[model samples]
Target chain A: MASRMRIRAKAADGVTEVKALMSHPMETGQRKDAEGNPIPAHYITEVTALHNDKVVLQAYWGAAVSQNPFLHFRFKGGAEGDTVTIKWVDNKGESQSDDTKI
Target chain B: MNHHRRTFLKLGGAAFGAVATAALWPLRAIAAAVRPNAAFEATALDGAYKQLGGTPAESADIDLSTPDIAENGAVVPVSVTSKLPGTEAIYILIEKNPNPLAAGFMIPEGTEPFVSVRVKVAQTCNVIAVVKAGGKLYSAAKETKVTLGGCGG
Candidate 1:
C-alpha cells in the first residue's frame, strides 16, 4: 500500500534531523455528524522512527493529536546516504511506512 | 492401556496451551508498549498523571513553547525540549481537554530530547510537557488561550 507520510531527513555535523507529516483523520470520538450520530474514534496510536533499521524514537499518541499530524525530532550518528524510516499504526490496526535518504 | 492413553492426552493439551501462550506473548508486550491506553483515556490531569505513574516536579530545564493565543483551537503548535541529562521520554498533556493526555515519546540513546507537534485544544488551557530523566519526572507548562473549542460539534 502507498504510504500516507511525507518524510524528510537531513544530516549535518554528525546529527540527523527528521520531519514527517502523516495523513490521518484523528477523530476524537466526541463529535457528531450532521445526522447527529457520534463519530467513532479513529487516530494514530503509535509511531516509530528508525535510522538504518535502529529504532531511534517512538511516539504513543491519542485522539487529541491534530489531523494530519506533523512530527519533528533529531538524533545523532546519521550520515549522508543513510536511510531513515517512519512507520505509524492507527487505532484500527492499519499501518504504513515510508523511508528516505539522509 | 486406558490409563496411559488418558495421560498422553492430558500432556498433549498442556503442550498446546503452552505453545499458544508463547505465540501470544510478543503481541501482548508490543501492544502494551505501543499504546498506554489508560493514560490517554484519563479525563483529568491528575488521572493522567496517576496513569503515567509519575510525580513530576516543576522544572526550569524543560522548555515548553506554545503560542499565547491560538486563533484556531483545532490545531495548536507546541514544542518541547528537555535539557535534563539522560532524558528518556517526554509527554504532552492538555489540561482542559476531555482526555488530558495527548502524546508521549520515548527517546532512545543518541536521540535528542526534543519534539514538536500539533495538538487539538478543547479550550483555553495549560499545555504541559513532562520529561523523564534518570528515573525522575520533571515538567514545564504554558497557558494558551483558545478562541474556540476543538473537540465539539
Candidate 2:
C-alpha cells in the first residue's frame, strides 16, 4: 500500500522534533453504515519510528483512536541530515512506511 | 498436545516478529511482556486498569492537555507530558468509551516524555493520561464535555 503519512522532522540543540499525520478511516466496529450495517473494526494497531536505523518510538493504538491520527514527539541524539523513518500497521494487516530527513 | 504446542509456537513466532521489526527495542520487551487486548476491549476504567496489571497513582507531575469542551466527539486532541524522571510509557484512556484505553506509547531513553495524538470521544467523560516511570504508574485526568457525539455512538 502507498505510504499515507505526512512527516516533518527538524533538528535543534541536539534534539529532533518529529510530527506526522497519518491518513486512515479508524473505523470502530460499532459504527454502522448509511444502511445501518455494522462496520468492521479497522484502525492502526501499531506505529513505530526509527532514527538513524535505531528504534526511537512505538505506539499501540485501538479503535478509540481518531481518524487520520496526528502524532508529535521529540528525541535526543539525532543531528541535522539524519534520517527518521515512520511506519504504521492497521488491524487489517495494511501497512505504510515513510522517511524524512532531519 | 499437538494443538497446545502449535499455539505456543504461533505466539512465539509472533512475538519474535514484533521484536525483529523494532530491532529489539526496549519497547518491544514491554509490549511483549504485556498483552493488553483485553484492556482495550474493557468497558470500564477499573476493568481496563485491572487488565493493565496495576493501579495508577494520581499525580500532579503529569501535564494532560485537552480542551474543556470538544465541539465534535469525532476528534479530540490529547497531549501528555510527564515531568517525572525515568518515564518509560504513556497511555491515553477515556472513561466512558466502550474501550477505555485509546492508545499506549513506549518512550525510550533520551526521548522527551511527551506524546500528542487525537482520540475519538463517544460522550462527555474524563480523559486520563497514565505514565509509567521508574516502574511505578502515575496518572492525571481531565473532563471533556462533548457537544456532539461521534464514532457511531
Candidate 3:
C-alpha cells in the first residue's frame, strides 16, 4: 500500500521538529451508518517515530482521536539530511511506515 | 506401550507450549510498553487515572492550550508542553468523552516534552493534559465548549 502519512522534518538550532499527518478513519464505534448500523471500532493504537533509525517518540491513541490524525513533536541530535521515519499500527494489526529527510 | 506413548505426547505438548511462549514473549512486551489498553478503556477521569496508576496534581508548569469554544466537536485542537524536568510521558484526556483517555505520548531522552493533536469531544468538557515527570504525575486542564457532540450519529 502507498504511504498514508505526510511528514515534514526541519532541523534548526540543534533540534529537529517533526510534524506528521496520518490518514485514518478513527472510528469510535459509536456512530451509525445510513441504516443506523453501529460502526465497529477501528483506530490507530500505536505510533512510533525514529530519527536515524533510533527511536525518538512513541504514541498510543484511542478512538477519541480525530479522523486523519495529526502529530507534532521535537527531538534533539537530528541534523539536516538525517532520516526521520514515522510508523503506525492500528487495532486491526495493519501497519504503515513513511520516512523523510530532515 | 500405551503408558509410554502417553508420556511422549505430554512431553511434546509441553515443548510446543514452550516454543509458542518463546516466540510471543517479545511481541507481548512491546505491545504492553507501547499501549496501555486498560487506561484507554476507562470511562471516567478517576478510572483512567487509576489505570494509569497515579493521582495527578494540578501543575502550572504544564502548559495546555485549547480553544475556548469548538464549533465542531469532532476535531478540537489541543497541545501540551511540560516544563518540568525529566518529563517522560504526556497524556491527553477529554473528561466528557465516552472514554476519558484520548492519547498518550512517550517522550524518550532528548525529545521535547511537547505534543499536539486533535481529538473528539462528546460535548462541552474539560481537556486535561497529564505529564509524568520524575516519576510523579502533574496535570493542567482547560475547558472547551463544544456546540455539537462528536460521538452521536
Candidate 4:
C-alpha cells in the first residue's frame, strides 16, 4: 500500500519507550466495496525494534488488525542518547525503518 | 509593517497557529484515538516486545477498563491500574486495530498503576495492558466495541 509511517523512540535508565504508526488500507479480506468486490489482504505482517542492532522487540500480525496501526512499548537497560530503531513490513512487501535517540 | 499588515500578521499568525496546530494535533490525536473494538485483543503475546528474558509477561493483577460499548470511535478513554509492587511501566494496546498497539507509557518507579489516553481503533477488539514491575512483564485485557464509523468519529 502506498502509505507512510511515523516512529518515535526514547531510551533511558535501562528502559526505553518506542512508539510506531504505519499507513495502510489494512483491508481485511472480509471487506467488500460498494460493488461487493472483495478487498484483498493489505496489512502489516511483521514489526521489529532494535537497540544498537541487538533485537529488542518484534511481533507478527494479521488483517484483523485496524488501519494505521499504532503501538507503544518499552525497553530495558538503556541510557540517554542511545539509538532505538524500529522496522515494519506488510504482507505486500512494503517496509520502512527509522531511529531516535533516548 | 503597516498597522493593518501588523494586525494581519498578528491575526494571521494567531490564526495560522490555531489552524496549523489543529492540523498537526489531529495527526497524533487521530493516531491515538480509541474505539470500541479496541478492547479484548491480546497484546505482547506474540513476544514482539523486548522482555527481561524468556519471560515476556509477568501477569500481575491489574485493571484495564474501557466502556464495553463506546459511543465515539475516535477517542476512547482507556486506563490501566496495577496492584503489583514497584510498577515501572504500563503499556496500552488496541488489540484489533491496524497495529494492535496504542500507547506505551514509561512509568517512573513511583508512578501510580493508572494511565489513560485517547486511542484510535478501527473495529471491535480487546485492549491490553503490559505492566513492568522490578524489570518483568505482566499483563491483562478486555473487549470494547465501536459503533460510529469514519474520520469524523
Candidate 4 lDDT tens digits, A5-94: 576766556556676666666555555767978778676666666777776654445454446666665656667777877777776898
Fnat for model 4 comes to 0.01
Q: Name the better of 2 and 4 by DockQ.
A: 2
C-alpha RMSD for every candidate = 4.7, 7.1, 4.8, 20.6
Candidate 2 lands at a TM-score of: 0.86
Identify the CAPRI category of the predicted complex in candidate 4. Answer: incorrect
For each candidate, give its TM-score against the true structure. 0.86, 0.86, 0.87, 0.50
- Per-candidate DockQ values are 0.78, 0.63, 0.78, 0.03
Of the pair 1 and 4, which is ahead by lDDT?
1
* Model 2, runs deviating above 4 Å: A1-3, B1-35
List ranges where model 1 is wrong by over 4 Å: A1-3, B1-32
- Candidate 4 lDDT, B1-153, residue by residue in tens: 588899989998999999988898878443312221232233443533432223345464888877788776655667677788887656666655644555454444322456544455566777777776776778887788888631232
Q: Compared with the true structure, what per-residue lDDT tens digits does model 2 show for residues B82-146? A: 99999988999999998899999889898899999999999999999999998888999999999
Q: Interface RMSD of candidate 2?
A: 1.4
Q: Which residues of candidate 3, in runs, are more than 4 Å off?
A: A1-3, B1-32
Task: Please give the TM-score that candidate 1 achieves against the real structure.
Answer: 0.86
Q: What is the TM-score of chain A in candidate 4?
A: 0.85
Sort all candidates by TM-score, best to worst: 3, 1, 2, 4
